[model samples]
Target: MSPAPWDSEPRAQGPTGPCGLQFRPRMDMAKLEEARLFIQSMDYRRTTWQDDDGDTILHIYTAKGQREYAFAAAERLQELGRLDSKEHKGKTALLVAVTANQPEIVQDLLSLGADISMCDIKGQTALHLAATYGFPEVMQVRGRERMPLSTCLTPLHCAVISHGATMKAPTSVQGRHTWLVSLCQLVLSLISQEIKSNKTALHLAVKDGNIQLVHFFLKQPLPDMQAFINMKAHGHTALHMAAGLHTSLHQEDIIRLLLTRGADPSVRNLENDQPAHLLQSGEQGEKVRRGRGTSLVGECS
Candidate 1:
């Protein structure tokens, strides 16, 4: 068999920049066979063929879709107590597999005892990457089982922010509603978990004017109604964000959802400004503020 593109010499730098790093190129059967043979002929345990970016042969093969080769390397590395080894960016094989959307490789890494909770330089875990990239399959990995609430906060935030108004439930059947409810429950649970910025997923959804997401969050059976409704980030509630978003065409609808769900529009932010004050001085804004006040009073009554 002829050599594949990956059989050529390693590039001087990765696509990200001129870091003088080299990574295995795209793979084919011939290159994979050559790599396997090379591994077999050498003291695979003591091989010094790491890329400039500190990626081991396992990392290279795992990322290149040479599944059999990657599995072989991974088994040997795990036996040698290096299954969780990180590349230059603190990316474990699991993180790489997750980022690459290689579910089979991800499973192999997890079964090999790769740490799922390991964070990169930015303190992002595999779950965070999965959620940020919208990979629900990766989120369900066995290694992620029983993850702590705090650890999932960023992933939830990522899911909400990344999804925005894009996620929708089809009106096909009861199963769709059930699935949507379950998804919303998961989203709400994560929204309650505080992140570094103290922002809930609801706050992000509102800020982005994701009407669909905001509605989903509001409809969930929340444990802490006061906390969920009045949760503040940067001294701004979801209501405040909805009202303050100048370009949001659905601001009125979002503001109404928050009010009905127990959001206190009268609550002031760090600037001592109420949600009503954030609205523009116009007929539409006035109408929304009046409607919000009426709804609040009705709820209280």
Candidate 2:
């Protein structure tokens, strides 16, 4: 009779500490072999045990990067109609795969019918976590196809917010922005989706002074570029956010870009304030204010 992996004292926890991905030292192959044999036997009592955290063998195997055992366990769980089972915290095995940064396992689980829309207690789906943590590993997995985009906040919004939070080098940020745009293109219809305050990803980029990302969104060959550029959140367009910035060099640049991209300066927000009305008072601001008028006139002509 094979002893269960957890039969020994001091059972290993796959996720620990603040990160929740600080896996114990490298997986012990000897134990992995034992788990594999046990799962292959399909013994319900040994394979279906849940720890105090409500993590099943599938969840632990996923977090520990034991691919062979994880895959076998996942299949068995699916047979039992519980592949998407959640831990106490609402994290499914797929979510654990993502948190563990195991892209291959993430792909395998998705192939095996893992629910992509499942979210944690915080209402964060796998895509949201991928976007929030800048886990391009997971992002690129679904990016391989026309990945379905769902959730209250689009992945674009999360990616844009994450891009701003990190202080990586310019080239690295640029690379990530490019990757995000490519992902957005796959689901172009949802590219302009909104979140809290009704802010779209474009509004977020402009608010963060991310001129490069702003350019990326505007430059895309989106079917409705005009509407996207002028899309409002709380009646505030990307142009309005740019115009109201505290007079930085990029503020004028962003204002000019938005106007050239057909942002309507006369479009008012809830406050009935147009983009021009929000311009800070300064030489730079005055220049952008004038630029907005010229662009509007050109559009009229």
Candidate 3:
């Protein structure tokens, strides 16, 4: 049998510094082809080689964007009982593919029975990485499975946190509005999943000044709205958080949305401060109060 890829010796070179310059010996194509043929013949022993970092050939190929090669290697490796082998950092080939945003490779690995729930040392799963990187298509594939309740965060939290300011306002077109509403529904579904934090996704949305997301929550059925809308943790509602952001451009709109949807403006936080008290003392506060009428805060109180 040909020498394994790892067994190829490095050629010695002249010392470049305290350490000698050791040049890596290139693999002879003839020998590599021989190994490939051996692997094709189901020689599991030779094909299961791992590097010093514990990355199998499948990991290397998948991370290098060698899609076809990675697929074939994955098949062989899976059969040989090494498909999900992890590297030094506890990253599997599937995690690497997701982080690299290689959807095709990710799909191939999933078909090969890669564990979608596997997380890295940092507790980030493939779904977490996909959401954090804004790869919604990849997220759709991995998200079909019921995800474990993420200890610190869910994909919904990651998606909202990673959301950029570039999202344009929906036009008056009915189709676009419908599509946006559907997308928001998906987000809400994600948000409804259990998380470890006391603060809900709406709290994060309000803190981020995500008016669109806040508006979506307001539009849900009253029962669902009551479930999440006025949710209080740390003694603050979404309204309190929005009201506290004196610099938010969308503050008035968000506050109005919350109040109209049954948010209690009179609710006090841990600091014993009401939402109206959190509002800025100036024309801005008067402007918001004026737009909604004097009864806005009074009626809620």
Candidate 4:
């Protein structure tokens, strides 16, 4: 058989024989669609990075303060795949959710596959995180955020007292304070606990002068500090504590937000004094403003 002109001529053949296999590159739409469907069907958690500290995607997401994304990722991972099987640092997804100060997310994670009995590297569970941190606004964590809401009374107040008790003798409890990341999460816990009318997490953070926590709470969706400024414990919101502790930029802003939010300038306490009155009294008065009795003083005549 006579060879083709291209095959006969080495120059025309390019490198190999005439059959160089010149074919157009197809898009492979069918295979691409299959890959997309596979990704959509799989659980997000399965492909998530393993946290260095054994924290799960849920924990990192919560700590990151991505509320909507965190919950949605958890939901998607749960609905499409195994949720209870998820873990980080020997803790389950439920525990991570609680530690992140996400009571609602905690409940949802639990419904999927969370094991309440599971503990973290520090021997704590979701309940412990909820208790330790309390709610950002009310400082309550009675399981109200859960489904078929719990009948138990808010436990955050008790948790704080208990934690303090440990400090009294110097608990030497020997565990990680992993529930905290940003002061924002801590504040949220205090609020969920209905911890108002006492030294709130915001109040505590201010007294501690943790500027990071201060800024964090300020930017939150429902800031605990906004309603808590300048009032002496007898009358002092967080601003009162900041003024007495050592005022800073956020502290001043806290006062403005409180005022704008309508924190009553005329609201009086046992001293029969308003926030303005307390402010004018003296530095010594502001320093002594925070006390155990202050909680009661603010509550009643």
What does candidate 2's lDDT look like per residue over 127-168, in tens digits? 777777666657777754444445677767777887766446
Best by lDDT: 2
lDDT of each: 0.65, 0.72, 0.66, 0.44
TM-score of each: 0.74, 0.76, 0.72, 0.32
Q: Which regions of candidate 4 fall more than 4 Å away from where they truly are?
A: 1-49, 79-81, 85-88, 110-113, 136-301
Q: What's the residue-level lDDT of 175 in candidate 4? A: 26
Q: What lDDT tens digits, residue by residue, belong to model 4 across residues 76-193?
A: 5566564544454666666565655554455445545555566556655555555564432111232333322132223333344344433343122222122233222432444542
Clash count for candidate 1 is 0
Candidate 1 lDDT tens digits, 67-126: 656766777777777877888998888888877766667777777777777887667787
lDDT of prediction 4: 0.44
Query: Which has the better lDDT: candidate 2, or candidate 3?
Result: 2
Model 3, 150-226: lDDT tens digits are 44776666656665421432223343334334334444462353345456667887889988767765665655666
Candidate 2: residue 7 Cα off by (Å): 11
* Model 3 stretches with alpha carbons more than 4 Å out: 1-55, 165-196, 220-222, 293-296, 299-301
Error of 4 at 146 (Å): 10
Order of the predicted models by lDDT, top scorer first:
2, 3, 1, 4
Residue 113 of model 2, lDDT score = 89
